[model samples]
Target: MEPEPTSQRTSANNSTYSAAGVDTAAGDLAVELMKSSVKATHGPEVMGGVGGFAGLFDASFLLSYRRPLLATSTDGVGTKVAIAQAIDKHDTIGQDLVGMVVDDIAVVGAKPLFMTDYIACGKVVPNRIADIVRGVADACSATGTALVGGETAEHPGLLGVDDYDVAGAATGVVEADGVLGAELVRDGDVVLALGSSGLHSNGYSLVRHILSVAGLGYGDRSEDLGATWGEALLEPTRLYTSPLLRLIEKLPGGVHSLSHVTGGGIAANLARVLPVGNWSEIDRSTWSPSPVFRVLNDIAGTSLESSEGTWNLGIGFLAVVSPDVASEAISTLAEDGIPAWQVGTVGTGSRPSGDFESGAKGVDGGAVRLIGTYRDGAK
Candidate 1:
């Protein structure tokens, strides 16, 4: 029974999982390459390490709280990954995932405890997958979250070989009374706008459309941006969990409600965290949107206001705090290097005749409107 010559092997006998498009070996190699970085995010609280069926975290610390409310958030990097893949940059995108997921948890004043990532790719390019996971691991460490486990799935036919998408889920714990939400917001509460690093993880579809219409490639350098278009667009999202957590701990009663300006843009997202029967007029003049936005709007030949429903513009996270502690909160965020400013004040008995963005994202909450022209007068 001599083995058939290697070149003479029939298609039937040559068929394998690899031939079918999945590469188990590359997946294993990816895990191996990403192991150290993943482990670096683990502390004593993380049990069973990587490659586990499920991640384990020690929850005994919650015993110290009279009542613990667990907060969980899950999100993907959105079409922002399209630019990363176009530019072949995998590292920084993971931070965007963390910023989207874990930062959402921080919106409720929760301290992220652990995170798990899921990467779906058309092919398991070991180094590329490893780079993606390593990015996730690094961000998890930065946010004090344990990267206990993750899955790298190969969806060969479903996606293009060079295409991949990353999403993650994070869990955080907060004291029952420490939960920040609309109920905690009050009349005369000052809304502090925290500056975003750039376009976080939303509105990329529009960005891509604008760039496509302008016939610009991600690799093309933008004289106005001072970097490649992709580089400017892929600027890692600012992680606010650590800083917001510090603000909460440092100024116990200074912080009340919080909002992560994502998906729905500023006013809509902020409206979600405001108490019913209350409204706030976010002053656009308080801060100018970063250049990345201005550049894109200029390319698209539209007013910045046109994308207000789709982009964060400039603000990333909004904090509604008691007026007395508003200045202290702004100064506190500044200590953490996050520029903060008063965008609006919560008010009651407001009866505005004009349209307002309220009850967004099925929250049925308060109303918000962007008043005043942008500082740069772009509106």
Candidate 2:
């Protein structure tokens, strides 16, 4: 009687998890698609590859250092992902993620060892995921970092199928004595502005606002930009890790501090690594903002003062170096194809009053301001 008549449970509706928005099979397929690119970033030191609960990496090399301090950074592409989504371009956003995460490690003079990424999307579109992971792997390889593992989560109802956000975490190591920043920065240190590739994964909220106010879409082409808005805005964030790592190694003690200019613009970021007592006046005339920035400013009719706090303007990274070695650093960076110039100088002064004196995340630091005016197409 318990056995009763044999019956198989079946639903009139062919329901599946994919029908509910999430597709585990699609996620697995994405993993298969991205495996090669992820592996390409791994070296002999990477222990276990992808598809693991946790990534394994060999830290035995750190044993050689007298005192190795690990540096870790986590960052996202921010609202810049909106631009990528609007443009339907997924490849470059991963590079922006890597740039934001790994480059911060470089600021402390650490060599990036490995990176992991997180992708949250409403649906797992295998091709799009592959494009993003491929970009991440390419960037990790370029920066000499291993892409050991990552996770892609599909949240069907929480976000739109076409909407996604990318973030990454990177770990690096530096000898304790080799960490670069405020401790090494001093008065008379020259501030060099490393030119940006474009608006490197920051200030896009303002960018979108201006574009919308001007009644422009991502596909709109501007004569000034020489490309569609999407193409211009999607410029991948420049990876400063390699060039900067080389600069630090080639000229030890020459680079005092490095500021990765992202969210808070030049003054704010540069102030982060500056000592409290010293101030810096960055000459805005040193380099012109990229056309994308200039166009947005023109369209929005925003003042440089208003934009300074939100955008990188022109400079992407600032290097504080001893004046004696400034020229060498500039020349070496130039040889590496990174255009840099002395944009300001550290001076003796008390931290200024008001918001200007506050560094990134409201940490107290020296006064920093962008003086003068942006040059017209200085390049």
Q: Give the top-scoring candidate (TM-score).
A: 1
Per-residue accuracy of model 1 over 1-379 as CA lDDT, tens digit each: 0011111222343347667787676776787888898889988887775665677888888888999999999999999999989989888988999999999999888899998888888988888888888878888888999887677777779999999999899899999888889998878889999999999999999999999999999999999889999899999999899999999998887798999999889989998998888898888888889988888999889998999999999889999998998888888889998999999899888557787888787898899999888887432
Off by over 4 Å in 1: 1-15, 377-379
Q: Show where candidate 2 strays beyond 4 Å.
A: 1-16, 350-356
User: lDDT (0-100) at residue 158 of candidate 1?
Assistant: 90
Q: How badly does each model clash, as a count of residue pairs?
A: 0, 0
* Candidate 1 clashing pairs, residues 3+ apart or interchain: none
Q: What is the TM-score of each predicted model, taking all chains together? A: 0.94, 0.93
Q: List, residue by residue over 1-379, the lDDT tens digit for candidate 2.
A: 0000001012223246447666666776788888888888889899875787678888998889999999999999999888888878899888999999999999999999999888888887888988999999999999999988788877768899899988889999999999998879888889999989989998888888888989999999989999999999999999999999999999989999999998888888888898787788888887778887877888998776678888888788999999999999999999988999989899886644544544778767767877777787756
Model 2, residue 180: displacement in angstroms?
0.5
Candidate 2, pairs of clashing residues: none
Global lDDT of model 2: 0.85
Whose lDDT is greatest here?
A: 1
Question: Candidate 1, TM-score vs. the true structure?
Answer: 0.94
What is the Cα-based TM-score of model 2? 0.93
